[model samples]
Target: MADTGDNSKTELVQELNGLLADHFALYTKAKNFHWHITGPRFRDLHLLFDEQAIEIRDQIDVIGERVRKNNMTTLTSIGSVAKHTQVKDQDSATLAPDDMVKELRDDNANMVARLKGMKELAEKAGDNATDGLLDDWTDMAEERVWFLSSFLK
Candidate 1:
């Protein structure tokens, strides 16, 4: 691929791909927790998790499209996701409600960090469109972290 005058284009795309992978992992884990959570707050947590998962899924699609806009193919398959994702995977087993909330809080915090990093990369690469997108994504992830943290308290 020819350089678009900015040498950071490739690196920026790679970072965006990582963000996409993290969102994928987080979305699956949120769905897992949604399915397995039980206890006093079952209904509330279940609904929250499902909503968060859908939002994360939508973010993943936006990110993949961004990659395409940057002229790179999006990552595909679980293997590719695993390679790029920095979010930790959870066992496919039931978890206590508090534990599920805690895990998601930490993961969302991590996602916020990743989004910030991507935002910086996009700025450095002069990719204003991606930088703008990251602003919305980072705000959403930060809200998830806050809500999950509050729930655990």
Candidate 2:
């Protein structure tokens, strides 16, 4: 049997790790778009992507702090994040502005799904703090997806 304290902490750590991985992956993808996007939408997309990347980075710190609060180590390496994240890195070099928007929309949707799953896990584990954190992330991701999808319509 697992000790109660450690078990709860472990659960929180696992959820946090997954959240952190998603955040990092999103960050990379956003930066990729920011650096590679071109065409008529270049100016707007470049600034938007930069803003979005910053938002993801902010969430990363929040997730890392949550892990630390749970008395667990945070995963900080690219390899570790890649291994844990469900988000896929894209080949940005070949993508057009519309493609970039579509990719980000898909990524935001993926993140929303992941955060919802994490929220359920947090609730089951009685981790309100984590649930609250995920709630914020879910809202932001949904908003981002909406904005990105609008560009393609």
Stretches of candidate 2 off by over 4 Å are: 1-9
- Tens-place lDDT per residue, model 2, 1-153, is 122554655765786798799889989999999999889889999999999999889888888988887667989688999988878889658698998888889989988887887766676667788888788889999999988987888
Model 2 earns a TM-score of 0.91
User: lDDT for each of the candidates?
Assistant: 0.89, 0.84
Model 1 residue runs over 4 Å out of place are: 1-6
Candidate RMSDs in Å, in order, are: 1.7, 2.5
- How many steric overlaps does candidate 2 have? 0
Q: Report lDDT (Cα) of residue 96, candidate 2.
A: 85
- Give the candidate number with the greatest lDDT: 1
Residue-level error in angstroms, candidate 1, position 54: 0.7
**TM values, all candidates:** 0.94, 0.91
In the range 1-153, model 1's lDDT, one tens digit per residue, is 345686688899998888889999999999999998888899999999999999999888899999999888879899999999988999857778888899999999988888887777787778889999989999999999988998967
Clashing pairs in 1: none
